[model samples]
Target: MTKKFVTLDDFLGTHFIYTYDNGWEYEWYAKNDHTVDYRIHGGMVAGRWVKDQQADIVMLVPGVYKVTWTEPTGTDVALDFMPNDNKMHGTIFFPKWVEEHPEITVTFQNEHIDLMEESREKYETYPKLVVPEFASITYVGEAGQNNESVINEAPYDGMTDDIRAGRYFDDNYQRIRK
Candidate 1:
């Protein structure tokens, strides 16, 4: 069976692009000092690093779309969308549908939760998948404080320190506690 793909632009909906700054970093350190004479011996210093970042736009629909085929033997297919350029892409799962129906048509609409009273009525018959968003955190700490291995070991330890010191929740910790 031959598969066909389509883009989301063919459907009706709104496309939105969201972007945020991922941030920057820096590091510095000094090694051994001269013991014989009053002069400096082995020493090292490191610089900083930064990153540029952006996110792609996602398409949001308010209702459910319908996928129909003429042949009972035809296989069901999944739909895909592209918000960056406003396109809807999908592949036909069943070749029988093309052979029997000749021309197959699918409806793509916003998947609004309020349209149907019951959740089951809304998505009981279709496939539901959630795509999670990705985020990046740039590490910028004092020299010798930003070791990659240490940084990765207990990434959230810093947060615990803030919480334990009551800085995380207590807004006026500086004045109130002291």
Candidate 2:
């Protein structure tokens, strides 16, 4: 039998964020060739430790994710998340111990920041309650090297295609409010 790989959306959409009392911890590189301990909080992405680069993106997806971390004192930290509130949050805790690392540079990636700004602009223009008809769903799955599943889905019912397509905003236009 061939193993089937499911798209992130399909796998996550059906799940719920699991929780635990024990915190999770992991090592991440500091700017100065030092390692910092990160604590995982509850109500956020699971399995992945806090301060993990991929954890941020995992939270953005529409699904439940959980995370756990163990502190220096041996206390456990946990985080849970639901798909709806995932994108609303960013990096959680950045400990002072890790800040001393000279090799670690804490900063947002240019591409991610740009995409976030664009999403904010669209959200402001169309209230969160109103799902735009032109909103596209990014398919993370790949069928082949050249082809992927990314495509835009139709906007809300009764909205015209033109309206949906017209509402599309360019990434360059969104200014970082902060």
The candidate scoring highest on lDDT is 2
Residues 87-178, model 2: lDDT tens digits: 21122343332223312222222224454334433333221121111111111211221111111221223222222243322333221231
- Candidates' lDDT values, in order? 0.23, 0.25
TM-score each candidate: 0.18, 0.21
lDDT of 1 by residue, 41-60 (tens): 11110111111101122234
Q: What is the C-alpha RMSD of each candidate to the true structure, in Å?
A: 25.7, 17.5
Question: What is residue 81's positional error in candidate 2, in angstroms?
Answer: 3.9
Summed backbone clashes in each candidate are: 18, 32
